[model samples]
Target chain A: MNLLVDAFAWIFDPAHQAGANGIPTRLVQHLGISLLVLLVASAIAIPVGYLIGHTGKGRTLAVSLTGGFRSLPTLGLLIILALWLGVGLEAPLIALIVLAVPPILAGAYSGFEAVDRRTIDAARAVGMTEWQIVSKVEVPLGLPLLIGGLRSGTLQIIATATLADYVGAGGLGHFIFVGQKSNDYPQMLAGSLLVIALALLSEGIFALLQKLVVPRGVVANQSTDVRRPSSRRVAVVGFPTEERK
Target chain B: MNWVIENLPLIGQRTLEHLALSIPPIVLSFVLSVPIGWLANRYRWSRGVLLTVLGLLYAIPSLPLFVVLPIILGTGLRDSVNVIVALTLYGIALMVRTTADALGSVSSDVTQSATAMGFSPWTRFWRVDLPLAGPVLLAGIRVVAVSTVSLVTVGAVLGIKSLGLLFTDGLQRNIVAEVATGMVATIALALVIDFALVLAGRMLMPWTRTVSPKRERRALPVDEAVTA
Candidate 1:
């Protein structure tokens, strides 16, 4: 009980608020690494996912690839990479990029996959070129799922980035580690509270983005299908179909 | 390589320890999630709230959970039960929505027919809805199994024993082989469990064998592990 109070006190303490290892500093490091990883991962994954979805090839490969990567324990990978690459952001960056790729890739292709085939066929019948169809039709329709993927990817990277300190890359996890090393439970709790808050905040932002990204017309059409809400978006994270409701 | 060969018993022991720590949460969470999933599915209003809360529960990272749980639960810092409890929470969070989706996937007509035949809701769920939802539930549980096995390694950082012990110990000792062995063992354990789940699914739900490959592919997705 008192520990919870101390944790809140630690977070609010003015002295703890302004240093190299301050809460603000660690938060930036965490978000910075997460953003960089998301950007790089999206760049690499989005194109390949688009191609696969656009062509309807290599889905089995992508699924297997994601399953394989997903099973590779993150912490183990982080430590091994740190050992091989030497202690720095480089190792953690690579490891996190790997972690971030699968969801983005799944999101990219699946977003394209979610667009109605009849819609694409109509676009073709209207004399649209392949590129025009892709840029104009598929991308917009797929944007919500793509953003959904990004949202999941963003949440994951934020959560995992806390472990950057394990490889000597500083983030909020540093507090958890430092506290663990010295038995400072208050600091450890404070760090965890911050990470949870950040994750929830990001989840909220992405949820809003997902809502806003839906084509207004599609939203109108989807109203009839409200009872079956989750059927359209592939259950990427087992998000309840009713969650959107 | 020699280091791996010499540490065969140690590796095997760690693998055993990993399974011991992992299987309970997978089973417990699956059992617990089904009812909650049923509740979420049965009540339209509760679905959003239940799923959202569970989703947020999962977003909290594992390591922090491991450290923070002792403070919350008043367990020892290195307690294995803490890892089990934390993993179960994660498993339930991930599985609940999947379970709801699985139950939702059941055809309404089939349930109505069963009802017309005089089966009560309880009997209908066990004999009809659950079996019909079997394939998806199996996929969800398979995901839970693989991820739980892989995640058990994280506990080693707090000095709990599992294959992850190899990574921490190897790093401190500067022995790459030990860490590599740990990675292989963890993946191998996950694969074995995943394969076993598939086989079990086949045996338990033989009707799924006739389901189209295309339909089967749609049933599983990458998001389960992503959220984990």
Candidate 2:
């Protein structure tokens, strides 16, 4: 009880503040690392996903590998990366990227694969280039599921970012790690609260993004908003807008 | 190569250890989730609350949960119980939604006919509702099983002596082989578990096999009609 109280106090301690007000420095550092990780991972994974999803062959292998990647332990990966990269932020960044890639790749592949065959065929019949068909037809149709994958991946990255601190990469996890080491309960709780807050906030933001990007018409038939909690009326018109006939 | 030859027995032991940790949680979660899902389905209001709580539980990270549990419950497997509890919460979140969705998917006419024929509510649920919902529910369980298998590796970080322990220990000791072995074992175990569940789902819900036939017939007409 005393430990918990003290930990809270440390979180609000004005002198130790890392940012504006009493916001901890470690949290900012961790969030930055996590963002960097996500950006890098998405850069690599999205293209790979697009390729594998679009290509008819080797998809099973690609998907299986992605699943394998997802199951790898973040902490263990970080430890190995830390050894290879020599600690600090880089090791955790590598680990987070590896962790984040699989979901994004899977999401992209599944989303692209799910694009209605008729829609793609119609797009091609209308003289749209293959690239244009993918960009204009397949991607739009697959947007919701793709965004869902991204949302899940982002939340996962934020949660696992805490482990970065264990490898001396320094994030909000630092507070928790420090608290655990020193038995400072309040600091640990404060760090944890911040991590959860960040995760929830990201989830909300991504959910909103998914709603905005997904074709309004497609979402209307679904009862559950798999992406966001907000009930917005998005218009989803049935495919083949009639002119193709 | 040399390491493989030298530590073959130890690698085998670690593999077994990993399976032991991963398997029990999945089985326990599945066993518990089914009953909870059934109960939740029976009570509409409680179902919503249960689902909300379980969804929130899914957001909690394993590491912090482990750390907090030891503080609250004291050391060892008592602390490890947090992982089980959290995993079970996740199981309910996923399984309940799937169960509810599956049950809802059962045609109303089927239920109405059953009721009209004087079948008791209990009989309707068991003989009709459950059978129809079986494939979808099993699909959900398959997902949960795979997730739980992966999650159980996290238990090793808290000193549960699973594959995760091997990785953690290897990292701490700077023994790359141990970490590699542990990771390989974890992946292999996860795939095996997932395959086993897929097989089980197939065996238990035979209707899923025929779904492709139904889908294909619909697809043919739609494609020809639309193309024409």
Candidate 3:
């Protein structure tokens, strides 16, 4: 389609190729913010999630709080944060971090829930230290779900990081918003394509990361379990299993 | 705070608008995704492709999708259908796998026994499978409900009316109170819907009430809202 051609053309145009506000600069800014938010969210969520999962005392908070967090409007939060904190990076950064937290948090503790009880019981029978057991046994077994949380959080931040433009922060959203304002359909499409590409690329990279770190036994199970490659993780999230016996 | 207190009626109206724009897509998608979910669960071959496609669709950003919808549907830029249709697409993407998982969670042996007892397929689904799958399906629905309510605010980006207008209007006008109110209202609405679904689940399946909300939620988790 001509629209498609125009979009590609706009992306490749030389005039748009080199500058402070150029596409490449925006792309780096976008990815930088997304990566920073993902790290911060992981830092805050992973340890707490691991503790809660290990203790099994906070499943209620995990379930209900994430449900609440999932629904907080990101754009609105950006607006609110910008109003209170001044129109700058801090607002969008905070807003994006809040958006990124719930999944990472859920993935962690729930991933612990997903751990095979026999595995943990085996660790205890062998007199493994509590910390050693968590680090050596639980976390590895729970890595898939923890990674699932990361996958979810990263994708969300990537999508949302675009909204930074609204708060006077620079990102690909600037292109999209400006394109929308000027009725530059090609540029809008170009920005959308760029964003979608980045998101898909991130997913591929994470999938590779998941494969690299997943324990061998789980990796074997992953190939067989087709519904959710992480069926073990799903079983832990809240499905009831009936005893056939 | 004083302005928000004096403007209670406007707040109520905007909240209602928010719910109206949000709730329909959840119900509409739930009704439609059930059969699609059923098919996905029933067909082993299609399951992988189905979930992967949906997951990819889920990855599409909400804002761009909002802008793209009008162009794809040949609708006017301002039509509320744009928002409804976009939310519905997202809802279906999120719920189909969850519904499939809920049905999949129903043990095969149970369904087999019902079949052996001479129940027809449709009756078996209605009597055996659907009831057993109810808790998980309902949990997924609640997630969708919470997500939809929150997502409705994004519709304001295109000037689609909802509580999100307060955030936009407030920010543009530098009224932090209005923005704060919208934030509080949106979060509150999400919690209320989540609890309402919990109550509905308990009432529909009285056995669940024995477990407190804490334990019950634990037994049946929901974050396809966030995860998807």
Put down candidate 3 lDDT per residue, A24-119, tens digits, no spaces: 999999989998999999999999999899998878978878866787788888998888889779999999999899999999999999988998
Weakest 10 consecutive residues of candidate 3 chain B by summed lDDT: B219-228
Segments in model 1 whose C-alpha atoms lie over 4 Å from true places: A223-245, B210-228
DockQ of each: 0.36, 0.26, 0.35
Per-residue lDDT of candidate 1, residues A1-245 (tens digit): 89989999999999889889899999899988988999999999999999998999999999898778878998889999999999999999999999999999999999899999999999999999999999999998888778878887887788678887877899899998899899998998899888888888998888888787778876666532122333343445666764443
Clashes of 3: 0
Instruction: Give the per-residue lDDT digits (tens) of candidate 2, residues A1-245.
Output: 55556656776787767553345567677678878878888899888888877775679887778766656666667777887777677778778888888888888889889877887888889999989987878788878878878877887788788877777877777777777677666666677777777877887787689878788876775664221122333335566464222
TM-score, candidate number 1? 0.91
Ordered from best to worst TM-score, the candidate numbers read: 1, 3, 2
lDDT by residue (B108-195, candidate 3, tens digit) is: 6688779999999999998898888898888889888888888888877667889998988998889989988998899898888888
Q: Which RMSD values do the candidates have, in order?
A: 8.3, 7.7, 8.1
Residue-level lDDT for B59 in candidate 1: 80
Task: Write out the backbone clash pairs for model 2.
Answer: A7-A186, A7-A187, A8-A186, A216-A234, A216-A235, A216-A236, A217-A235, A217-A236, A218-A236
Q: Quote the lDDT for B203 in model 2.
A: 89
**What does the lDDT read for residue B57 in candidate 2?**
67
